[model samples]
Target chain A: MKIGIHGLTSCYGCQLSMAVVKRILDVSEKFDIKYFYMLSSAGKIEHVDVAFVEGSVSTDEDEKELRMIRENADVLVAIGSCAIHGGVQSILFSEGIGYEEAFKTVYGDKKMDYNGRIAQPLDKFVKVDYRLPGCPPEEEEIMYYLATFAIGSWPEEKDYPVCAECRRAGNPCILIEKGEPCLGPVTVAGCDARCIKYGIPCIGCRGPVSDVSWFDSLAMSFRDRGMDKEYVKKRMAIFASRYEGLNEMIDKIYGD
Target chain B: MRYLKLGSRNIDEFLGRISNYGDLYAPQKISEKFYDYRKVEDISQVEFNYNRTITPAKKYFIPPKHEMFEFDMETGEYTETMGDVKPFVLFGLHACSIVALRILDGVYLNEYPDKYYAARRKAGIIIGISCLPDEYCFCNLRRTDFVDIGFDLFLHELPDGYLIRVGSERGHEIVDENMDIFEEVSNDDIENFKKFEKKRHEMFKYEGSFDNLRYILELTENSPLWDEESEKCLGCGNCTMTCPTCRCYDVQDLPDIDGKHGKRIRFWDSCQFRSHGLVAGGHNFRETKKDRFINRYVCKNAYFYPLGTSYCVGCGNCTYFCPAGIDFLKNLIKIRDVVGEVAHGEQ
Candidate 1:
């Protein structure tokens, strides 16, 4: 199968993780590498069997590139939190701030290079066949996606939260016990509760699990735990600003 | 039942000798407040007075991630991957946990027996020890506070040492093997053990009655408490995963990039997870959180109550590990209370 690993406006962390995978060489050997800018400079908009597009569509250029990849590829998988939920940069969208104001504050009227817009997930611009969500996708998930595609099968997405693995790992609940604003209860599983294992609560870098996140319920619980309503909203907006029904759900609990 | 006494000082030596038989797994302190059953490399690591482990002993029989079989796509051949399950002694189990294991035995060993669970269960030896109930524990309410037949050997702590009650032939063999460490159970020792049991019963800070819970749940099927509790539930699956009797699982085929070879694996799944009720056509039977929440109560109380078992051992792992702090016992009582109010008003 022809494979393309493309990046739009990401930190390149997802591509770096994918590149350093122990079985990347083996995976490359099995599939036809049509395009991957991280691995090579043969940057060509080419057709591929499976395309793993990372990063959010933050600029017009990114949107164009994503659309091109979608048009060429038979299957386009949105990889990492950036492509799946618009990353931390999408915080501006959820914070009720305009992209131009935030851009001006950061760039301070610098000379134009590319058309900048409020960052949005890949699905907002193009049809995403599947999504591999993480700040950087898990190595096991990366391998699973590659292997399943190789065998003409599809990898099953996790519909459960991080707490599934967290509880299984026998880690103490930081949310209830320590009163930490742990998002493990709302975030998708598959990072093996990595942050929680290290005694840190989850910041929900993997974004919400498609439809069953229960943001309103979690927000209300967070309020009961004495967290500021805005603080909870900002924390959720970090990687999941573009999460489906996230703002509405949060508003349902905290809105006047 | 045969009874013997083991001096507390000789525990390390007895554990050391048993290491030759199989791997000795005992409760070891993970953090300041948490304990888990871990492979004891050193005898000093064993914690005797732990309240409860994060997960139940069911993890030993049905691991969190179990590779069921490895299959070859080209040849259509598969091999069951039940690894070399060596004889292992699971030491320091509490009464509630022992009862929970029996509940698991009913599920995995009855009807069509799970080969993997049976293999692991056969390899394991249970050594029950008395534990003081913490604020979360409600084993007394569930009638699982004292185990007599489930464990091979049950140790009740006394002022001087431990009074060991041998339940199985294996327990007798163990006593014979470590005869030097044991002493003849005197009448004073038996008297002390009985006194210790009475004291332990009074030590439980949490108390409740779960009698007729099935009927109460049945009557309060449409109670608003379900919605109230479901709102607080994070749907994290912690309660189900930590629950000893929860046997739900999801199977997956993990293929190597070669496309010809793959392994079929089963992992612990939760009924609370939205996808648990998702059928092939994407029709979720339990679409609302209230449905899933109420289903758990019904499964634990109503579903199997007619069979003389509630399926809940009241180990308190669910309440203890819940990020949302949804207490199962409290919910049951609340549901019962709601039904009582409605019945009283009608009268």
Candidate 2:
């Protein structure tokens, strides 16, 4: 099997995490890593078994590249939280700032003429067979899905809340022990409560679970803890502004 | 079920007993209201009842600064390094925190199968203990409690001694190795355990349910709340840094003095920061604080949900740790109420 990895406008953590897997194990033996921008020279698109795409589609170049990859690859997997749910880049779409204004602000005084467009996850433009969601895709998870895909068996999707795993891991409940607000309950299960296990609370980097209502419960969980309603709405809006349902709920509950 | 009668003073004896197995890591008081897990020679220094540590135990499985590979610029060659540490025992894990580890395992072990995380994970054994609820605690609200995933053994403190619950085959091995120190549980002891659980539950309550969070989040979009809430955010990133589940990170290639040999390092990044979404040619996606601020919650509550699981755990850490004192709970209510008003044309 051959796999190609690409990055859009992301932090490159997903690519780094994949590299970490190679160090830990000889994944190269299983699949031929045909192309990676950071590791190898950009190679011509070939008929590959799987193409792992990272980051969000923020530019015309990214959109064009994503479309080309989708056309060639048999399976397209959106790796990293950004690629799956726009990571942090989707924040632009929520604000009224068009892509053009955003570009001018960043590249001030540069004679770069370009049109503005809202950033979106790869799925918005092309079909994604699978999604490995995380700010930086967990190295182990990437391998598991790949191996599973390689074996011709689709990996079962996880639906448990982060709190479920947190409980099963036998770590102290951050909410009960420290009165700290966490996103474990509504957030998806994957990150192994690493933050909570390390004495920090969950910040929802993995994204929400299957149920959208879980986010409402998370916000309510905060309110029950005596947190200010407006504060919760603002904090949640930062990562999921494109989720119109969640946005409307936040506004209603917070009286915005 | 088994019972052990180790005195608090003889905790060092317990550590000594376990040392024969492998390395021992326990919570040590770093400062007032702060504790860190470190290699310990003496068990007396282990603080079993800290509210919560500044860092989550996830560091052991996934170190904050791990070297995935080393590159030599002179040769343009890369050498991958695997972290092969000895098997170590982590002592004094809280229930919520352990749940956090399980969440990570689900992500790392399932679809992608992270070799680095899996390799490091195999080198450690977890020992958990019950935690005392504090003012900021809300684990009950999230439906979290003492659990036994990936842990060999769990310790529940009693007035007279400690009750040990064997959770795995490894736990049974540990117990059998130290058979002299443990005894079988009796009917009376089981009754006492139930009483203890009851007392603990009385002190803890489910703060709220996430059932309505999605609806609230959906309505809040384009609501005035985004502007109102963004006004107070300083974008300092304290919330993300202190978050247990916030795994967003930035990878940078660090060059050596000669710029020939350098290592790539991953550091925690936050959505709250303005530059978090910036790309090459200087295109910033999330330019406004309002957009950035709203995206954080959406990622946790809405966007991540359809993909798989809800990223947020409702631990209340963001509320306690926010420097600007942005309360997540209040925001939920405000968003819900406002979205309702707007929908009803009452605005």
Task: Identify the candidate with maximal TM-score.
Answer: 1
Write the residue-wise lDDT of candidate 2 on B64-126 in tens digits: 556777888778998877646788889888777777777767777775688877887887888
Best by lDDT: 1
TM-score of each: 0.95, 0.54
Report residue B197 deviation for candidate 1 (angstroms): 2.1
- Can you write out model 1's per-residue Cα lDDT over B102-218, one digit (the tens) per residue? 887777888459989999999998999998887788888788899878888998998878999998888888888889999999999989998988888898766755757777787
TM-scores of chain A in all candidate models? 0.97, 0.89
Per-residue lDDT, model 1, residue B262, is 91
Instruction: Score residue B153 of candidate 2 by CA lDDT.
Output: 81
lDDT of 1 by residue, A193-212 (tens): 99999989899999898878
Taking the true A–B contacts (Cα pairs closer than 8 Å), what share appears in each candidate? 0.70, 0.00
i-RMS of candidate 1: 1.5
Task: Give the C-alpha miss distance for residue A102 in model 2, angstroms.
Answer: 41
- Chain A vs. native, model 1, TM-score: 0.97
